[model samples]
Target chain A: MADTPPLLKTITIIGPGLIGSSILRRARQTGTLAQKLIAADCQEAVLHRVTALNIADETTTDLIAAAAQSDLVILCIPTGAIRAVAATILPHMKPGSILSDVASVRSSLGPEIHALLPEGVSYIPAHPMAGTEYSGPDAGFATLFEDRWTLLIPPPGTAPEAIALMEAFWHRCGARTRQMTDQYHDQVCAIVSHLPHLLAFTICNTADRLSADLQTDVLEYAASGFRDFTRIAASDPIMWRDIFLTNKDVLLATFKRFEEDAHRMVKAIQEDDSEAIMQNLQRGRHIRRGLMPEPQN
Target chain B: MADTPPLLKTITIIGPGLIGSSILRRARQTGTLAQKLIAADCQEAVLHRVTALNIADETTTDLIAAAAQSDLVILCIPTGAIRAVAATILPHMKPGSILSDVASVRSSLGPEIHALLPEGVSYIPAHPMAGTEYSGPDAGFATLFEDRWTLLIPPPGTAPEAIALMEAFWHRCGARTRQMTDQYHDQVCAIVSHLPHLLAFTICNTADRLSADLQTDVLEYAASGFRDFTRIAASDPIMWRDIFLTNKDVLLATFKRFEEDAHRMVKAIQEDDSEAIMQNLQRGRHIRRGLMPEPQN
Candidate 1:
């Protein structure tokens, strides 16, 4: 491991938020960035904190200046802002530099951002399947991505060298990596991540709208099951809003499937169809048990 | 306190399942039952395990023999079986004894079981908000209920002495106690526990029905949000089925509310209404933050 060269001489991360800060911490912990690290954000306060915390060698509000000297630039901002931020940085990006982002949806975003890159620059999209409900620079830690999967959505004709470099970066960051088409990435995440967040958000709001008396009780007894949903529902709203908008088509399709499933189970409960209810529940338990390596006895 | 007497002189717990065994473990650890601890179940295997574990002073398949001399009797069985089990034990229950259950629903069950009890015996309904996804006697532990809430739904004319005794019993088992009307309890739990479990079960089944290729990706990337739902969905199916059946009215009403909320959010996402989407998501986060006494920064 010590004989292995650093993945990049200098890496510039735009947006020192939760995921970005975690990347910085892990890189510094492992000395993965050989020469320098630059942190860029729109807010002076955030940049000030990043510098004070010593998470970066350089800090700036100028995206282009921060990215100009780096061999790799990762956009760790919201999906909606990625286009504008990447457009700002592309003109100054050096030839042969790698451009990437950590956004949930990538089908359309990958191609759009790829077209923005200089002919010699590469755009590789990655979605790390890791996070807590908390956000901001202080909420992150070095091990956030440990034992997590980070899917790299490399477009067709992506250079083998570029893919290999990005995969190596993720590996060094303690994440298992897989390369997939952006369309398939969105589809898989639509069912697993996007739909569940949608359910948790809607369920939490529904409970909020209950009568004041009942709402109090709902919070009081939340640990019964609702607490799990609320933990997810407390996630950054703007990030999720962008995910819903960017991944609208795949998510709507998944929502339709979920509605149908909910409808069938609702009817079973309404009609006192105990066997149907039990079977549906049993299927859920069976699948969940399969998820674990050792099924609970 | 050591100066305080044990909550009950003798107790019989019917159905040594998860909650039942947790109660047994907690009682044994705290020395809360002074004279006798009887474990009664129709299954000889469960009774055998209970005896082998030394959790009970006496083990029996005969409900009458177990209840005959007990000062308190707890029906820690599924909701549907409570009526029959109560009927079996009522005729043998000592006069002035307290009879309670650890079932999730109380509206229909309370009145039905109250009707089954003999004139001198009192039936109090209790629900302890503590559990894991696992089940059975082996899954139970002494600290399962520590710092968790246990609701006591005492019907009208329930003796002050009876209420005090049950409250003290729950306290000794390491749970805070609250008393509420049966109707209110059903409403609160329907929104918090019942609806969340129903949603988890239905969502897990929906993911389970995905195409094999997509299902594999879902399991691989589940930590994004689906893992939390699966944890709830994996709970004992028979226990949850009985809960939905017994609490059907309130749950159906809550489901209608959830459907409307979900439909609104789905439309928002489909129409690409970023403002509406953000607002809905923000409301969820706001209410979730409000639930925490010390909100996460």
Candidate 2:
């Protein structure tokens, strides 16, 4: 692996937050993505921290300057900000450079930005299914994407070389990669990721509204199941808000389906129909068991 | 701690599944509950396994025989079956002995059973706020309850000695104990534990209804959030069904509130109201951070 050449001459990552800094750290640690790693963020304080961490060969708050010298520019900011950031940096990107992003939602953002890319540049959207509840530069780790999946949504007619390079880059950073359409990615993620986060947020709000005395007990006695939701619900508010807003149609569609299923169980419980309740619960357990991956190292 | 007297001479745990086995193992490991640890289950194979593990000083298929010799009897079966099991064993419980249970729901079950205990015998109810998704006897460990909270719901005017013994017993099992009424335990657990599990089950079912290809993607791309739900959804079906059935009223009440809150978010998303969505997500994060316990060892 070490004998293989670095995939790019230089790669700049904009927005040195959880996902951005993780990419910086992992790419540098592996020495496979770029010969020179540059970090860029809107906030100077974040850039200062990036410089101190030494995960990047250079750090700048100027996205355009950072993009000028790089073969690849990764926009790792919120979904809502991706287009603005991409437009600002695209003018400075050299011809033949690849522009990519790590936004959670893609259907709206990916195609819109891909169509706006200059003729000589390529755009591919990637979503690494990895994170914790925490954010910011310090929250990142080199192994954040280890044993996780990274979805690559390349625009149609994209060159094979660009696709291969993106695939190899994520693989070097410890993620398995899959290719799909941006529309399909949004639909699939709405069910798997977006709906789940929405439910967790709603559930937390549900507990939040408990009568003051009961509220105390709810927090004090939260067990494993609720604790897990709390961790997910505790994720970055603005990131999730942007995700929901960008993927609104698909999310609302999936949530409608989820609410129907949830209400079915509620009705079963209300009627004291143990058979229906048991059957629904059994189906859930069966599906989850079948989907259980072999234990990862 | 080692020099302290055992809380009771003999303690019998009926239906030695996950919680029951953990209690037996932890109590015996600490030597603070009973000198003679008795295990009772309907399955002879489970008894054989328990005997081999030596977690119990004696293993019995006969609940009556186990209860006849013990100063304390704990029913650890499903919520629906607890009353039946209690009736059978209460006939054999010695005078002045305490009858207790580890059922999750309390307002309905605990008081009803506590009222039926034989004269001169005591009844104390407990709900241990600890568990993993796994079940069965071998799935248990002595540390399952470590750093967890256990709620003790003693009936009004109950003997202080019985309360003290139960408190010390759970403490020996590595839990801190808090006292509350049975009615209140149901309300608290309904919001925190029961509602979360129901939502997880429903979310899993929602994914189960997806097209076969998308279902595969849901499993493959289940990032930390959905993955957490899958683990909770994979919990024992029979156990969860019983909990939902027994705690139906409180659970339905909580679920109604949750559905209302969820729909509010759904409307906000559908309308592209970013501020409302962001506000709800932020509130969830704030509540979770405030309630996080000191890091467990």
Candidate 3:
């Protein structure tokens, strides 16, 4: 068998929070990136955690300085902050360096990032579909990416070598990599990720808004399946807000479909149409089969 | 302490499916039902599974005969079927035996159950806030209720001795039992379990109805929060359909609140209101903390 190729000569991760730290840890452990693993974070405590994890060879608050020293730069902060970080650091990076990111939605980011990429730098956009409700460096563990899928959404004219390098990095980090068009990726994520978060968060709030008497009962009776929503609803707020605002069109499109289906179920219940309600419920079981992470038998 | 009083002199479980068998397994392992533990199901295969698991002293297809022999009788079938079983077995049950059920909903049931109770018998309603999406006798396990809550909702005039025996049964099964009115149990579950299932089924159908082109992409993007909904959506159909139909008013009431929240979020996104969006997202974390299962830590 042919030997696997190294991901990069050196790696630089910007804003070493949960997502960034995972990439750094996995890359170093798998020897995916040779020479050095570098990271930059504005917050000192988070950086301290990242350094303690030893995923980064060096840490700096200066994005530009870090950008200059590494061959692969990963933008890992919230979506709203990516453009600002790019503006500050891109010019300091070497010309051939590859820039990728861990944004949830890709199309919403085009304008800000396009205007700031250093001339000649290859920007292969990525969204690693993995994370927990927790955040910061301490929230990360090496297995976060195990068996997860990561999409590398590259601009059409990007060189093969740059795409190859980014794909290799994600593969070593325990992700199954797939390439997708930016528009398709955003639309797909809207239905899958964005809508789920919005629904979970909104539903949890609806329960909490009930009278104090009802609130305690709601929590106690949460056995009716509200427990799962609580877990998803707990995800990072600043990050999700930016995701909703940025992916507005696609999210709205998916939410429209969700509301329509729910309205029908409500109608069926009101009319007491056992057949319709039963069919809808049964079909859910079939659809859910496709969605579960296959558990070990 | 006085030698632990036996929770059951003889216990009868009708309908040994997933929930039924789970209760039996827990009862036998915990020695909750002291003298005898019996089970009845239509399917002989299910009977054998129960016998093999040894959660039952004997298994039969005769509901009335089984009820005739027990000190405590539990109707462990789905809701729509529970009323029929109650009617058939109530007349034959021992006169002073306490009758109860593990149905997820209660208010809609009290009137029917109260009227059907055979003379000189007590009817108590209870629900264990626990289950897996999986079903069938083979799916039964002893620890399903380990940290879940079991709410016992009986009419105001219920005999304390009867309530105590039922509570002891659940407690021995490893559940923390709380008492509530039938109306309160119905309302809380509607918001937490029924509404969420409605949302899951609706969203799953909506996503499934997406044009053939986007369906594969939807599953591809399934790793994002979408997987959570898929898990809930995959639950048993007959059970959920009854939930929606039986708990319609409360589910509808809760739906209005959820609809408003969804509208606000979509509007915030369309208008690009970062402040409104973040505030809404932040509310989820608050609910998540309160919703954690108390003994999990």
Return the top candidate by DockQ. Answer: 1
Error of 1 at B242 (Å): 0.8
The clash count of every prediction, one per candidate, is 0, 0, 1
Q: How do all models score by TM-score?
A: 0.98, 0.97, 0.94
Candidate 2 differs from the real structure by a C-alpha RMSD in angstroms, to one decimal, of 2.3
Tens digit of per-residue lDDT, candidate 1, span B1-297:
556667778899998888999888888877865557889999999988898888888898889988888988999999889988888879888879989998889867777777777878888888998888888888789898899999999788888988998998898888999999899988988988899999999989999899888888888788758998898998989999999999999899999999899999999988888888988998898779768853444
Query: Compared with the true structure, what per-residue lDDT tens digits does model 2 show for residues A167-283?
Result: 989999899999999889999889888888998888888888878888877888888878888888988899999999999988998988988998899989999888999989987
lDDT of 3 at B88: 85
Model 3: colliding residue pairs: A224-B193
lDDT of 1 by residue, A177-249 (tens): 9988988999988988899999999999898898787788788888757898998999999999999999999
Q: Which parts of model 3 are misplaced by more than 4 Å? A: A1-6, A292-297, B1-6, B292-297
RMSD of 1: 1.3
- DockQ of every model listed? 0.81, 0.73, 0.68
Please provide TM-scores computed only on chain A for all of the candidate models, following their numbering: 0.97, 0.96, 0.93
Candidate 2's C-alpha runs over 4 A off are A293-297, B293-297
Candidate 1 displacement at residue B205 in angstroms: 0.9
Task: Name the regions of candidate 1 deviating beyond 4 angstroms.
Answer: A1-4, B1-4, B293-296
List the RMSD of every prediction in angstroms.
Answer: 1.3, 2.3, 2.8
Ranking by lDDT: 1, 2, 3
